[model samples]
Target: MGERGRDRSRGRPLPLGWDEEAVPADLGASTSRPVPGPGGDGEAASAPASHGWSRLSRRSRRLIALGAVLVLVGGLLIALPRLLGAATGPEQVTREFLQAVVDGDLETVRAHTQDARGVSTAALTAEVLTGAEDRLDSFEIRHVAVEAGTATVTAALRTGTESREGTFTLTSSEVGAFSPTVWELAPVALPELQIDLTPGVQEIEIEGVTLPVEDLLMNREEHAPRIAVQLLPGTYDISVPQVTPWTEVPQRALEVPAAFEKSEISVHDLQLVLADDARAEVQRQADAMLEDCAASTSSIPEGCPFAAWGTQEDTPGTWTLTSSPRIESLPIAAFLWTLQGAGTAEFTPAGDAEPIEVPFTVSGTAAISGQGALQVSVPAEDSEHYGYCTDAENGYITGVVVLEEPGQDFSSECA
Candidate 1:
């Protein structure tokens, strides 16, 4: 150390292994500079600057902008219609459903409905509904109300010349997590036509359109056949096709109310009127059968009501129909007209000079069962109204036999 406290290490031995060469050459001068990197330059090497947008070519940038625009447009296209539909709300949905029915758009109608309870939906077809002459003419929406998640739409439907007001119920549901709500009509029990018909009836004409009964048959309730037809608000004329020589039902008009107004139409019994000629035809058939039976040579004609015997064993009685059977009334039961009448047959024994008149009552059915043709059977001997005339030798015909001959005693004819 120097006396004045100045370091004299330059001329004297450095203390504690200090090396003057390792020290900076110009340590007292002030200087600032970056440390050298592995490349040995005074400043660190840097890679080229990379900006994503700047890296793309000009045309590529234009294409990217167009793609973004298309995505935005596609999103809007998908959302716009849903937004518009939502704006119209349930009232519009109700109107659309009714319009679909009138348009005969079955797919749309099914989509809008929740549950359609009808035994037979055959008449609900687009073709059938469109072809119906009594189909709905038009509809007008009167009012709309919203409550909770449900909606009520009041409307009037015009069918033919008649108009009726009714209410429709609807409920809303979300289509998807991102989609707008969808409205659907609530459960609608379609109107039913309960028609009372003869069991064998095959077809019926409604509004001048013929439909098979088997296709329209929905159910049988209270022993009456019920046909379920999805009818619009309209008046329909229904008639059974002519069952020839037996029964026919004239066209009857039925007014079907709205779906929610009245769900059922109990069309009164299809009162079958006996055809004017049917009665005469049945009568003629009965008389012909009786006459044919009387023509037999045997004492008791095969199916005839009378039997006569001669005193001798070798002789048989000759029989002839004195009075043809007359049909008093033809009452139908189970598709058959039961005949009630009486007839007379004269029988002459071979030895007797005079003929004995035998009176017989007739009772049986005129059946058309399945084949559309008529068949009459009026056998007095086998039927409930059996009457036979015989002498004491023939066994008694049981169950209150009556003698129509004023002078003849009952014991002689019955016993």
Candidate 2:
């Protein structure tokens, strides 16, 4: 039995359980195997592997191909929208910027600009937005075009009854991960205020501050003076001194817009005729002067109207002003004025003598005194007649006195 066992160990094979075929399959062998193809060589010798693949059902093959195709298409779908968004980011930012401006969202607008230094958001909202919104009826974004981190946006703006198109330009830059692309706006310059005045406006006052006309007249364009001034956004009360005696202009109120680059204000229409009360007051003072002159016992009383005449001796005749004085020139002030006028005076000789008529021109200053009394004064000139005359010769009154009444001429008898 030992010889037979030794022979079996040496020569005879064991059962299938202990044979090499019984070893477990290697996990890597299937993957490491060469793929089969039509090329002739060792690679073609591996063509038998294709037979196993061919054994699969047609439906299974189609499912595998479709899954592969879906993977490729899904990857592109995930990446495409992000790329498109980056490309159009500037345009989106521009649209948002304009929307903020129109809505008066000043904070948001400031956030979108890099050059917002010294810009007041409150001023923008209060002055620019308020004024624009009051006039704007509608607003719409027309188009947005983006290129190379810069964008231009066009919009249609309807203000009052007018419709206009406008444009805004914006730039973009990378901010951070959360906001990869941030946009900004260019700096805007402050605005100017241009004032156009009437021919005789000597000076202007704004907010109790006087502005000289000569200074504003510098850099004049043609004969028309340029009154342009640089000012911050605000409301202003402007006043111009009187230019003519017959008219008084009122103060002008103006509101400067925050967004205005340049604006014009014209003061041509502000002139108005002198008030009736002022005109009547002046006429009354002149009439009182004439009456005082007629009642004065001296040839020329101190406050008399004809005191401007250089007569010395007391004339033995009753004097009367024959015509209403015509005011030729007047210098206006806040509460005083200098007035000049012409009239005729008649002197009747004491002993039934013919009356003599004299023409005269007089100038006097009138004012409201402390006691609410209107005081008038005629300033005397050297070698000229004024006040009570002590002595006079070369200052003779020479003009003819032609007195025309409603129905008769009193100077006709003298002629």
Candidate 3:
């Protein structure tokens, strides 16, 4: 058979079940086979990759691949509609526009609207819109119509319990032959607002933004300024900030309707009225001054509104207040506030003289001296012959009474 077979036969005997003569002669012979090489010549090949992959049948691998493809296609089918809905449609754009208004997204709303001439964007801010009451709460697309390159979308808008139908017009244009259609909202014209404010207010606060009257006035130096502004449909708060500790103007919150009617908003005589606390403080100070005057025993009290003048030379008298003076009226002026009140004062001259009771009125001027403190000035007694006029309605006394030579017609001198 072969030299290796003859060597194995001479060395050992075959097993019991193995037949030596029946065995093939080429059983132990060595042989060589051709293997592919990089150059495609006959050479030994490198070992193959893992046998696990090689053990898989072609049909099994193809089946697994087909299953994976089906899974991917099913997922795409589920998500395709949502992705398409987000990208293209005029109805989608209309919905987005309404949603942006509800969200107070000024940028998005401006992006959707077409450019208009003379559009005022000063009040077109998210903060202003957000501060408004009865703003757009929700919306639903009711109808959509497309004809030629023009489209109209009607939406049901709701604010609070009020519902209204708002229609939007859109125009589509092809940018180029190969480009897709582009849609934009048509220009909308809204109403204008004309505001007339009072004189004392120099500045106003609307939706957190401070507006000065000088800037808003048609004529820069006008006493009572007017502000003309165009804003989106919303309610706004207009108020004057606290300019002084003694006075304030009431806050006004007005709503600018969505209708196209020209509206005029006027707020006149918003006077710098005295605050409650300031009035109370003024009354307290005035009361204290009168109390000190009543406690004085002299015939003429210095720096006091009331005095017991024309008394006998050697007679001492005491002035007592029967009714305390209260601040009945306070009138405000540029730098001073006038205070007036009416009360009864009793003056009793020495031992045997009867007490004289007079319905006396006091008038004084108060001003803010420094650090918000009040400085009050009242008339005191002096030697003179003068006529005093009494304003019963205003509780003010205007006069000059001079004793020409002590008790020279004291009653005739006062009027």
The global Cα lDDT (0 to 1) of model 3 is 0.61
lDDT of each: 0.62, 0.52, 0.61
Residue 111, model 3: lDDT of 62
Model 3, residue 232: distance off in Å is 4.1
**Poorest 10 consecutive residues of model 2 by lDDT?**
382-391
Please provide TM-scores, in order, for all candidate models, with all chains considered together.
0.51, 0.39, 0.44
Query: Which lDDT tens digits does candidate 2 get at residues 266-382?
Result: 444333234455566667766776776777665555645564244446755578778867653243332344668888887765776676777777676554332234445543122
Locate the minimum summed-lDDT window of 10 residues in model 3. Answer: 15-24
Cα lDDT tens digits for candidate 1, 1-415:
3575574444332322222123333556422224577777667544234434444555877788899999999899778767876766878877877888777787776564434354555555554465456566688999988888899999988766667787888888876655777887775555767776654455677766677777777765424555666665556677877645466666787876655443667765664556767777877877777777777766666565556634344247678888877786444333455677877888777674588777877776665433345556666334232233322443321212322444444344333
RMSD (Cα, Å) of model 1: 20.3
Clashes per model (N, Cα, C within 3 A):
0, 0, 2
Stretches of candidate 3 off by over 4 Å are 1-89, 112-120, 190-193, 213-221, 230-234, 258-273, 277-415
State residue 141's C-alpha deviation in candidate 1, in Å.
Answer: 2.0
